[model samples]
Target: MTLKRLILSVIALAVIVFGLIVTGIWGPSGHNPAPEQQVQTTQTPPGMSRGEYVAKMSDCTACHTTEKDKPFAGGLGMPLPIGTLYSTNITPDKETGIGNYSLDDFKRVLREGVRKDGGHLYPAMPYTEYTKLSDNDIAAMYDYFMNSVQPVKQANRPNDIPALLSMRWPLAIWNWMFHEQGAYQTQQDKGAEWNRGAYLVQGSTHCGTCHTPRGVAMQTTANDETETGFLSGADLAGWHAFNISNDNANGLGDWSNDEIVQYLKTGSVAGKAQAAGPMAEAVENSFRFLTDDDLNAIAVYLRSVPAVSEGSTSRYAQGEAVAQDLQLRGLPIETTREEMPGEYLYMANCSTCHDADGSGSPDGYYPSVYHNSVVGSEKSGNLIQVVLHGVKRDTNDGEVFMPAFGQHLSDDQIATLVNFLTDTYGQGNAQVEPQDVAELRATAE
Candidate 1:
């Protein structure tokens, strides 16, 4: 053959090879559980309120709804690394929602992470962890969504992304590398409650979706509580969800089992912490309804897990010992003069309840801002929302609620208090713009 013809042939071959590599056709196919293998749907026998309870425990509404106007209709704008993902309508609206999803279809999506049409769901759905749920649990979730949830008429908007990046097929490869299949394994050595807790947190609840660290590929670097990194917390949409592991400095090692249950139940425990952002929703809709045994199970499971460090990234660390000592050395005033502006505003408005130092007294009362992670986070979205929209933590043991504060705190004051708290403790660098606070304030109304 002529040199020119041979050169053209080589170019064509190179193009084909490059395409294969980019598309990951050369790699082992990712594990996508077969349709039947993934989810098993059976008729709900009588007296099985397990489905309804499971739905509440999963807290599906957090993503599936925007405001309370349309429940499970799914138009919430979920921010992503690439852009924004609009939640799909899960209501049984045949025209616009998942009304047509059969029991098996729902199960497949939940257990296998595939949509009704075989498209892989974005890991944003957390099916990688959900896939650990048993066939019975998937069926329970399906029954709850299909039979119980009120059908809202809402059309899901297409995901806001260019077609190139919106490609769902590539996720098949992602799943293969990171996703695992099968039901949660019962830990024989551990108690039944602990194993049950493991299944709920690691599987249906998919707590790791927010709490676990992500790899460069953006998948959960570690999937199980067995790994120290698992449930250690992750940053989502600029907000850092604090570590849930047993790390003394950053994780929950210091928090007692009762405190964990209390926080999950009531949103805040007296001197400890309060729920904020997506976690508030999880508490309000899900954990508050958990059975005492289940809450205890979760606490026990969390306590039993190993502490894995995802990396050297430190948000909570050894504070300057001398600085904390100096702050403590001073007879703590009710609130300092400069800090009093924010304090006075809070008193006139929030003090009848939250008290002066942002400490909610009377044991398990309003949230304490001192040393609280939500106040300390670099991202002010959750903190801003709490100030602007007030949050009730959760109702696991019983309901403990915080009223909305948006009407009371002006944008400047909110910004001032945020600055004061961050400066005093927390990651001191956090700053909120009046403009951003105003924007969020608009949403509160």
Candidate 2:
């Protein structure tokens, strides 16, 4: 071919690639901001009553709200590979929030990941999961936020991603490639309750955001329960979102329906597991408030999912409270920080709440270290996190607070204590090191 012909061919390829990248710009470049309107009605609206519950179910507070005083006036900064992305103000503040958004605009934001200005939202919004939300739920959410929530005039914080890498056009390609549009499809074989549970879990609650593994592109590997590895767990920051699938050993397989409901209701179920880290937040804000029927539905759906076990022994089945060494009991109570052995560390610090026998309180407030999934899991990340940061799960039962040992204990001491707990009451394979604790502590907020 002639040089001129070769140049023309290259230009054609460039045009195709550019077209693909800019495709989002060509589509419904959203409307100008709608004027703020006062909506007053004496009559009860269709979804007004259900609005708050749906918002709780969606767990919007976890990401959108940073300050207690400024609930939906979003400014929660989530760090990314590129940079930090701050959440937008979702409250109905006319100056700096979604106050001017129409119901249609709101729907588009959730379903299409598009804003009123036609810009695409990063998947951090979880619009992929929000796409499965029904029209009614979306309407209810809008109503709740616009009416009930107190809006502030706080401006949305700008992201810190590099200018060249921060271009929005490329996200169009990502959306096209990965976004699952439309509401969730109902399975014919599943019962009504199960379907309801599936709808909430797979759609609004966005459980898979944490539990489901991600692909190289930072997209969820599975969108729904039908797919393999859905809710099979993933690592977040430093904590691991435990497998919530029906897996007997690692997931919720051994949990009865009542036990699942109980766990969701109170953040702890007898002997199986207790919520901590992000899961605790989820339980406190979202799961605890769900209606009995909805909670039961979640239980049913969770139990029905295909088991994805890696080990035969249930995580809840492993571990005993047998004492290793009160031989260290011979040591002085005021042992030096550097000199305290693992068992000695537990006796000094942990044994008060967890008890000398590793069994929790008589009322089961402080959970038994034995028969606990956090202890039993092979990845000791959660165990390490709990040790460093402590557990803060506030349910109806009242605040459950475990004092963080991060400031008080050395990295070496934490590693030793966690290993002792796992070996005595969990799977005995934990090999946490001082470096691991230091690294995780460095990342802790």
Clashes of 1: 14
Worst 10-residue lDDT window, candidate 2 = 34-43
Candidate 1: misplaced stretches above 4 Å? 1-48, 67-69, 308-352, 357-359, 371-385, 393-416, 422-445
Please list the C-alpha lDDT of all candidates, in the order they appear.
Answer: 0.68, 0.81
Give all TM-scores, in the order shown.
0.74, 0.88
What residue pairs clash in candidate 2, if any at all?
none
Candidate number achieving the greatest lDDT relative to the actual structure:
2
lDDT of 2 by residue, 196-252 (tens): 888878888898999999985689999877789999989998989988899877788
Candidate 2 residue spans exceeding 4 A from truth: 1-48, 329-340
lDDT tens digits, residue span 1-445, model 1: 3445544644564565557778978544334443343323222334647787766677777778776867888877766656678879989888888888988788778867888878888878877777776667767678877887888887779888766567776677566556776566666576677777787788767788888889866788888765657887787754567778876656677788998887777676644467776687788877777776678778888886676544443433312211222332353455442545544444456656655555555563565565566665566677777777676544545655677766777788888777755665466776777787887765542
